[model samples]
Target: MSPVAVILTALPVEYDAVRPYLTAPEEITLSDGTRLERGPLEGTPWTVALAELGEGALTTAILAKQIINELAPEALLFVGVAGGLKDDLQLGDVVVATKVYAVQGGKLTPEGHQERPESWHGSHRLVQAARSALRELRPDVRGHRKPIACGDVVLTDPDSDFAARLKRSYNDAHAIEMEGSGVAHAAHLSRQLDALVIRGISDFADPGKSAADSSGSQELAAGQAAKVAIAVLRKHQPAPEETPGPIYTGDHIDFSGGTFHGPVIGKQSRP
Candidate 1:
C-alpha cells in the first residue's frame, strides 16, 4: 500500500486552504458521522487524509486518535493558523513546531498558581523535511522551526494573566494555538507514527487580533501554512514496506535422502 499521511485542521479556513492541494478526493464518514476526505496529494507519492476537527485540544486529541486508528497513516500533520508570540514573526509567517507545549496543566497553590508543564517534540524526520521545504517557499513568507504553546483559551490579550504565564514559562514558544499539543500527544502515544504541527501567524494574540481577522489575515496565514505543510510532504519520503517471503502451502517432501541445492521452505511436512 502507498504511504498515507493525515492532515488535520481546526478551522474551516484552514481546511479550505489545504483542500485545493488534494486530487480526486473522496469523502469518508466515520462511525460517529465525522466526515473526512482522502485523496492523493498533488505531485507527491502520498495518500493524504484530511479532516477539519473543530476547535479545542481535547476534542482534537480524541478525534485525532480515532482517525489515526482508522487510517493507520505513516505521519500526521496539523496545519492551521496561530497567534504569533515573538516580536519578529509577522502575519502570514509560517512556524513549524519543533515541540508543542501543553500550557494548561498546572496546580493552584497557596502562594500562587504553579505550573506543571507537559510538552511533546515534533518528529525529528518531519522537522528536517520541513526545513528543506522552507527553502522552496516564497522569500516573503518566513518560516521558523520553534516551539508552540497550546491551550484551551483563545488568547487575544497581550496583558492577560495567561499571556504573562506564557511569557514566563513558555518563553521559547514562537506561537500560541489551541490544538497542537493534543495532536502531538496523541501522535506520541502511537509509537509507530510521526507527527508535526505547522502554523501561520494570523495575529499577535492582542487586541489587534480582531482587526487582523477582519483584514483577512487568517485566510492568508492559513494558506501559507497549508503551502508549507504540502511542501513538507513532498520532501518527506516514507519508509518502504517490507516484502513478505514466499509461502508454500503444498504437502512438504522429506529431504532426508535428497541433497538439496538450496534452502527449503514449507508450512507443513508429511513423512
Candidate 2:
C-alpha cells in the first residue's frame, strides 16, 4: 500500500515523539510541485510545514488541500496539543477526538443555518485506531478515548466562562483544542478520502494557569499524542473494515438534552 500522507505544524515536542516511527521519505515535493528547499524534516515524504501558533483554520485548510493535490496520500493525520476541558485530565493526558467539531460557522438550526464561525470535519475511526494502538504499546499513556471536542476558532482563553461555555456546548467532548477543527476541515474539503485529527491535553486549561506556564506541559502531552497516532497508522491497515464509521459532522458543537447540535450527531454523543 502507498504511504498515508500526514501534515502538521512542526511543534518540536510532537516532531520528536513521532520521529521514531516515521520512515523518512526519499524525495520531497510541494502541492504545487515546487521542491521544498529547507526544513528540519526535509527531503522526506512525511513532510512538516511551519504553521506558527494561531495560524487559523483557513490557512491550515489551504495547506491540507495542497498536500492532497501534491501527495494524494491515503490518509491525513493532524497531531497537536490541546487545553483539557475536563478536570480529570492532567498534563500529558491524551484525548483522541472521536469527532472534530468546528464552532466557527453559523448555528445549525433545523429550520435553517444561523450565522456563526466557519468550521470543518474529522475522523473517528482514526481516533479509535490510535487509542487502541497506544493502549497496546504504552498502557501507561492514558487514552481519553471518546468523542473529542474541536472547533475552527481558537478555544484558548484565560477565563472560566470560556471553559464553562465549552462544557455547555460540547457536552460529549472530553477536551478542547485549537487546531483539530481546522485540519479536519482541510481534509474534508480536499476530499482526502480518509483523515484523522488527534490531540493531547498539555495543560488542564485552569482559568488560573497562564498558557506560557504550561508550554512544557503541553509539549509532553503532544509527544504522547503523536506516539498513539503513529501507532494507529502502523497497526491498522486502510482496509474497508478498518475505515468503517460515521461521517464527520461538526465545527464548534452544542449538545442540548443529550442531542448533538453540530454537523453530524454521533452515536457516542447520543447515549
**lDDT (C-alpha, whole model) for all candidates:** 0.92, 0.60
Cα lDDT tens digits for candidate 1, 104-215:
9889999877999999999999999998889878695699999999999899889999999999999999999999988998998899688999999999999999999999
Instruction: Summing lDDT over every window of 10 consecutive residues in candidate 1, give the lowest-scoring window.
Output: 262-271
Instruction: Return the TM-score for each candidate structure.
Output: 0.90, 0.68
Best by TM-score: 1
> Which residue ranges in model 1 land beyond 4 Å of their true spot?
246-271
Estimate the TM-score for candidate 1. 0.90
Off-target runs (Cα >4 Å) in candidate 2 are 24-27, 31-54, 106-124, 151-161, 208-215, 239-271
Tell me which residue pairs clash in candidate 1: none
Model 1, 37: alpha-carbon shift in Å? 0.9
Q: Cα deviation of 86 in candidate 2 (Å)?
A: 0.6
